[model samples]
Target: MVYRDYNISIVVTIFISLGLSIININTINSILIFGQNNVLSDVVCEKPGIKSISASGALKSHPPKNVIDGNQNTRWSVSGIDSWVQVDFGEKRNICEIDISWYKGDQRSYSFVVEVSNDGKNFKEIQSTRSSGTTNDFENYELKDSEIRYLKIIVTKNTENNWASINDIAFNMNKEPDQNLSDPKTEPESPFIPTKGYGDNIAVAADWSCGTPAKKTVKNVIAMEPSLLVVPGDMSYDNTGDCWLDIISPINDLVRITLGNHDVDEGNPESLAKQYIDHFKLPNTYYSFDYKNIHFLMLNSETDFDVGSKQYNFVLNDLKQIEIDPNIEWIITVFHHPIYTTATKHSPNEKFRDIYHPIFDQYDVDFVIQGHVHNYQRTYPIVFNGHNPDTPIVTDQHKNTYVDPTGQIYLITGTAGRQNHELIGQANYNADQYKGFGFLNLMLSNDGKTIKGVFYSNNNGEIIDEFVVQKTGAIKPINPDRNYQDDKNDQDNLQSNPLDSLFSDILNSTPRYK
Candidate 1:
């Protein structure tokens, strides 16, 4: 009996040991799995040396290299539907995530499938989704643990035209940690000054595209060596956002932009607005600045402009302050929708005129530059009673010059590259009209009283239009009233000015061009 009891005890001991051993093994396995996941999270999969990239077709100007160049300003563009870009890793890799920064990402949704392949030729679909169309930020897609050496992004559909563009691409490898994964990539910020002085000539143009006159127009603009380039609106026709930037890279740093219908017409208007604001580093949708003796006001016709709206209040307040500043000799307003146009495709934006024309006359604005007409039309120094353009209450118009103009000179210079629309003949208020591709090169005199504008055509270097604006005497400052004082006080009370924040690095810094 004692012998039997001993055997039973030995068997129980063996069972207990097995149980302990099983529990310890599971605990170790759990710890290892957790550690591996953490390590995978830190691994960056985008190692260009180990991968080869190819696209179905890319614009000659925009190549596949641009996708991996780490520059959002550059991009790879593919024409037509079912366009695809593939990245082939030399060897199989454990990929956990993929990130893509798309071109014109702010405006349109894109539908695509992510496929992976072990062999270079045969691919199996792994993931697919419709993008949210946020341009300024990357859209990240997480994948299940899979060994993939070759990856392909097949774009099946898009909300915009039949063009697909990608600014940058990235991946997260699952096996090991990568230092680049820890390094945060960010868009480079350009310098901007809220109120500064500039003396060189300013080049103004709009409606640039990839077509005939656009490239030629940009070439001419580069040769001009102007201190500033202001494109009022309709900067790009192709939804590939980087196309326009690439075309204008030579003068990009010198360029400033305003929103146009074409700019905000795609995808989500709000998303496009955010992207525009971020890409340009604008303080807001509307802001003012001083370049040399000129006070420039950039407005957003796409946004709300009715009285009491944020934009309206900003404009009214901005003009009031500029009216009191003695250094300001000229007030030039720029926006997408023209207050006056002779093109039959689009009529004068009477809504805009009724809202802002009175304020312009009240402040004695010098010039108003606009786009969206696809042609050039300059209105005489005229005032309006909401419906009709009438001669200014207190102004004069001569051959090519205006003396003491009572109203703003409306210049519609939209002929940059897009095809010109047929004009419905000249209007009674139109001082000049032209249907061609060209830009305005305005030279402000040293004395800050004369503005000589020359419109150079892209087709054959012909001078399409030329005019001059001369100020006879000092600009009368708007009378300082209690309301004006209160506005100034409110502006001063703000701890951080939006302009200062948007251009913190460059606001007080020395002018880049000056």
Candidate 2:
């Protein structure tokens, strides 16, 4: 009897060890491997009959057949009545935009409504819209936010009167699409919620680095609850080779990258840029997106800035086409080059200024964002064309002020998870400047009419800067004289404090694992 009892105890011990290993595997895989790759694995459960059951179709929520015709380019036609396109975000996210492409050009009157559900049995309509474009190709649409797990798109009628066909459907999330803010689901065994998230805010660090300290600082900043992460150029030293990729793992899903000059070399001047693309899937080196009512255009400074170049022409055409939206009240441009810097480290990219400033002026661009100089600086609205010092200025909103006749409001925010350099000098339209290693967290109101930029450090949850911009319809109010400009403000030009010393080593080294 004693030997039998001992055997039973040994069996239970072995089982417990196996279960613990499985749990650890799940936790590590969720955080490092599967989640970063945007892939979710199958879940298994025990059945009553002493068998294990595996769940399939967890990520296979593709649109149904006969929903949108992808081959026909003539008209929208429908055949099957029960077909519908469905998207499961794994959880609910702020529905910022939906991009669609229909094969039938000019044939279908694009109109659709969004129906959402938690359990997929019962559904409710959240928002509906008529076609925003004339052609079958439309991109970057705003979506509503709630506790949405399953999303269904149904086509009631089309211009072709047949069926609707689509080639691609891409969606964006404010933060994690699966993160539920109001309530959280947790396992009873663990005290910490596995899927905690940061709200929509940008992070900054006085002295940012890629070493352990910088890594910790960045992780802390991301933990503050930001919807996205924006790192100013100089992300890693020597383009930091492969090392930068690991440093960014914490905020990989919510990152957008712009290359600093340090990212490239004589051989592969675009290597760093290419690496960024390989790691993160952006539409292009420079592209545009319409979130809510705002139009955001990202540019490539290292690329061509002169007229006639492919990149330059693309920018022109992009702005021209974007003007079709009457609802677009604000235009924000992002790039790596600084066109309005007053720092003595280097001169402004005048060639770029001459090439693109006029187009921006013509289109009434409101905000221009750049990185490279390791400091935080905000500029009042001003023009670069050198046409009229008396050009009118128009402020986009109260916190975001611009010149009267009109130029663009240039903001330099490069202090995230990296080291900071002191501001050597000043500029004509300088509004605010700081030396810190942190990031900018921006929140756009549902309509995109108002935006708030919050700058904070991750080390201690200290908010160092904050500003708000409200759209006034007109990007430039039309300046009769060039007299309207915000007061040229200045602050102590101290070197931005470093987050921690350990980060420097990590950022400066090459990546170990691919």
Candidate 3:
């Protein structure tokens, strides 16, 4: 889509401006090389020159050929789960990008996987992603360069309906430059800096969608300038999600969200949730990441999470390994539902309290952040009781502060642009509660021993609630009553790279820092 016009006169003028003498062919080559850093400076690549386009099926007037006809009005519309659109380059060619304009893209998103092949019989999947659903124009999706003669898009499902339609599509490719620089003058580029961050402050809030509350919530979040923004759940209430996506565009790079009931899979292969995942480039619905000395475990409450289930096993094994690690100083779990809450809208789940509260106590988890009640509530560092789930063993009842806490303290900051819920009576377990639109600012101290939780109401910038959690001494497990298997640890075999294990995803794109 880009065209560059460079003439010998312009090159000579640039060379003359640089005060060059004895200009020859080699000197001219050097000047050309110096003019740009890209090796394919003179290479022209408009499209892959699609020889033919075919699809599994099409409606009456719409056909696959319309996709490559360079017309936005024409499109290929098909309806099926595994329906596909294939394109041929006539010969093997190196491709690195795909530009496509989906029909009615402004209304809904489409999910699909792209596969490429040198031979027509064997294909390799290159990327699994979705469209922005906000643009009818061409959106370029980059990929690794591979030589292929055949390419196809396998449509899974679109968000709005079962139809898969594309207005225009193009595969851009580049051939190896034939020109060689006899006298090169290109300097080495500087080391790349990461587009994301890992710093002290972590901003948290949830249940945000649209309207004035959502806009004000965004302002509050950006005001803190947090290195990381963790939204527990209930992110985009709208199925199209254009509203939330537009509002959060300012801090999309630093956001990490968990799955909520509203964000669950719809069996349209999880129509809305999958779109969110692909848009954010997340590894999965639930995952773990380490920031500085803190280990953040994001869980999916909408899916199965029983003791022997996949998510349960994941967290159990994950925490067992982190138990002995010397690097991790704090453990924070994030999810949608709450195990302990006095809010009457959504009653606390006794099963989660019985199953995970003991695990969090065992693994020395510090905080459990959740969103679902549409209000804010904080509890004292408490341990679970299977026989008596109503009254948890409140370890530290200082009300406002805990020093070297005995158990994991749970906090529900669900007041992130949603209807507020009222608590039952004066609950003894609740530390501080608020019913308003606000955000939770977890300010990590310089020594990394204390994390002060501050809830600021977005309406009047009032400090509705505040609490302090400090690890002033060694972690002492409460030895709470439990009925679960305890794995063995030799302490001698506790050898692993927590840094590499936690940060393997970002290593290729960023330098490690917090």
Candidate 4:
């Protein structure tokens, strides 16, 4: 009887050991699936088995699932205002961040608020942004220490016809294991390095948008490998700030921009301007910077430009400072509105001409680059009365090269790519004009004494217009009786004539006293 009891005790001990082993296995499986210590993967939202996605309303073909389909080409679009889309993870999950790719995201700005919920009923606001404009790129926002299963994005405002569209949504979830692992033996590719020897070449363009002919122009510009890019105005026609950012972010650090009318079209102008300021990290709307031997002044045409206005005073002081700097050989002014445009659709802005042209003439500004007319126009070296287009006194008719010009040369190159081409009818002041998509490339010599302007057509990849401006010592007299040739190679033989005495005196006199 004692032997039997000993065998039974051994069996009991074995049963208990098996039970404990089963419990431990279950615990390990739980840790692997939903443990807090798991490493999060880069693309947690793309994982299968999402609970559900719902939206306030969806257009006929665009359902809310398009946002979670991991495809940027597809989108969920709603026609009404105050639309929203929400996603549920089925179980409580730790969401650390959310990313969104906008749809039709150009030229317009979008305003939205992000909220999170634990029970899918009581939601709490986590982040609110006034204007989130970007195209074909994901804008990520971080969520701090909050564990929730439901995420909702509410669109409260938009600059584009009250439509709400989102291309894709992504999540960075905490406590998620990274399933993607490459072979340890494989080597990684090297990063891209731009070619040298083109550092001083600057590319100038405006009114560019993604997925358009301008995109090809931008690609050409990148291929040229310019050191810097100057966009005068009218960046994205859709007012989608984010879209513009996405299109230009590849060269973000190299771009210098000025404001345009389209950039400030939101309900609250201050808020809209703030979006631009924050994105570019600009000191102010109108500011100046020095690059190489060129001094660049970016003005705001939409703002007040009266003599007593802040912008006017800023320009006055900035020009004064630039004039005294001996190192600055060239003064290039950039703004949205053209002071002198020959396009018949939109005439020259009289206010800008009245308030700022005098300052430009006073400083003998080298080049004034402007947009807003949707074409390319290069004027003859002209001196104006600061209030009239008909008053443009052509100081020199030396076609492509002006040797010691008496006044600033104005260029309207708003044809980077926007709308239909403006009618390029005949204009007396316009030396050359083209109604096509193109950009101006300015090559400034190292000494800053000469600038070569070349307008390249994106459609045909040909040079449409070209000019050279050379600065010599003092102003020389001009004679109207002498005929000037349009040939670029004949510049060296051209000389100032005695008949241009009046222009010579004006050039020699201080413009501040005029």
Candidate No. with top lDDT: 3
- Give the true-structure RMSD of model 2: 24.2
Using Cα atoms with residue i matched to residue i, what is each candidate's TM-score against the true structure? 0.54, 0.50, 0.55, 0.56
lDDT of 1: 0.61
lDDT per residue for candidate 3 within 312-343, as digits (tens), equals 88788778877777878899999998888884
Q: Score candidate 4 by lDDT.
A: 0.61
Task: Compare the candidates by TM-score and give the number of the best one.
Answer: 4
**Which stretch of 10 consecutive residues in model 3 shows the poorest summed lDDT?**
26-35
TM-score of 3: 0.55
Off by over 4 Å in 3: 1-199, 265-269, 479-514
In model 1, residue pairs whose N, Cα or C atoms come closer than 3 Å (at least 3 residues apart or on different chains), thus clashing, are 45-173, 107-267, 198-292
Prediction RMSDs, each to the true structure: 24.0, 24.2, 22.9, 22.8
**lDDT (tens digit, per residue) of candidate 1 on 151-193:** 7777766665667777766543434432112222211132111
Which pairs of residues clash in candidate 3, taking residues 3 or more apart in a chain or in different chains? Answer: none
**Candidate 2 residue-wise lDDT, 1-514, digit = tens:** 0000111100000001111111110000000000100001111111111011111111222223222223223222234322245655565434423455554534444445557787766988754443433455443333332545566665444444434445443333333322112112211122211132212344332223344334545555555565556554545553334655777786777666655554542123355556665676555666666654557676777665567866777777778877786767778787776776757334566777767776788787877788766567877566553554323243322333211225577777765533334477666467567765445656555255545555544334445555555554544444534434432221211122132232232222211111
Question: How high is the lDDT of residue 79 in model 4?
Answer: 65
Model with the higher lDDT, candidate 1 or 2? 1
Position 330, candidate 4: lDDT: 85
> Tens-digit lDDT track for model 4 on 277-375?
778767677778888778888877877778897777778778887778887888889998888776554667787887777678788787898887767
